[model samples]
Target: MASMDVSLKEMMAIDGAVGAVVVDYNSGMALGSLGGSKDLDLQIAAAGNTEVVKAKLRTMESLGLKDTIEDILITLNTQYHIIRPLTGRSGKGLFLYLALDRARGNLALARHNMRIIEEKLEV
Candidate 1:
């Protein structure tokens, strides 16, 4: 099993990745963060993304969906924001947030890498 530190470091290796954070969306708090830009504070980003996660959860509940969220993606002009929820027991109630430059990111690969990271992460 990979420790949380190792998993996060692996996340930073993804091409175009600028920052990554493990967050508790339920609490709007970051468990850890790496490589954030001065223009974007990781703390503020984590807090705001909590609303996105909550809204989707509310919608899913209303729809009576039984499945869990694997990940969520938000595309912007210059960046792609990926939020991946951990399915492993050790990572319960937590998610990984990754920021990648759109020009350099391979979305499919990034998603696959995130799945791998989530699988190995020990929380």
Candidate 2:
């Protein structure tokens, strides 16, 4: 299993990755983070995205959907934001967030790689 630092570093290795973080949705805190520019603050982003995750989870419950979220994607004109909730016992209430440059990133491959990282992450 990969350590949190190792997992976050792996995330930044993805093509176009500008920033990455492992956040605890329950507390809106980042356990580990890597790569962020002046334009992108990983701490603030982590806290703000906690609300996004919580909202989707509530919406799913309200809709009576007995399902789990594979990932959440937010696309901007210049970037793609991917939020992946971790399902492993040690990773409950946590998620991995990645920011990618739209022009340089491959969405399909990023998602696949994130899944693999999530699986190997040891929290």
Candidate 3:
């Protein structure tokens, strides 16, 4: 298991990582962040993604789906944005957001690594 800082640092080690953050879905704020270029403002991305999380949760509720979101993926022309909600009881309402360069990232490996990171993250 890893603490927030450790987890964030580890996430940054992923191949093609452009940025990563732990965000509060309810408040749309970043609890921690790392590796953002000038063009990628992680805080703003976190806030915008808060809506995406909320919308999906709302939709799931409306549809009466018992399933929860494992993760959310947004594929852009040049980037891959991944949103993974924290699952621990203490981690409710928080998520991990990662941005990667599609050409340089291995989507499968990144997703698998993110899952491990999420499991080990200490809220």
Which candidate, 1 or 3, would have the higher TM-score against the true structure? 3
Error of 2 at 10 (Å): 0.6
Clashes by residue pair, model 2: none
lDDT of 2 by residue, 15-34 (tens): 99999999999999999999
Which residue pairs in model 1 clash with each other?
none
Candidate 1 residue lDDT tens string, 1-123? 888788889999999898899999889999998888887688988988889988999999999999899899999999999999888887888899999989998989999999999988887
* Deviation in Å, model 1, residue 47 alpha carbon: 1.0
State, as a TM-score between 0 and 1, how close model 2 is to the true structure: 0.99
lDDT of each: 0.90, 0.97, 0.94
State the weakest 10-residue window (summed lDDT) of model 1. 85-94
Name the runs in model 1 displaced over 4 angstroms: none
In candidate 1 the C-alpha lDDT for residue 40 amounts to 67
After superposing candidate 2 on the true structure, give the runs of residues whose Cα lies further than 4 Å from its correct spot.
none
TM-score order of candidates, best first? Answer: 2, 3, 1
Model 1: per-residue Cα lDDT at residue 15: 93
Ten-residue segment with the worst summed lDDT in candidate 3?
A: 7-16
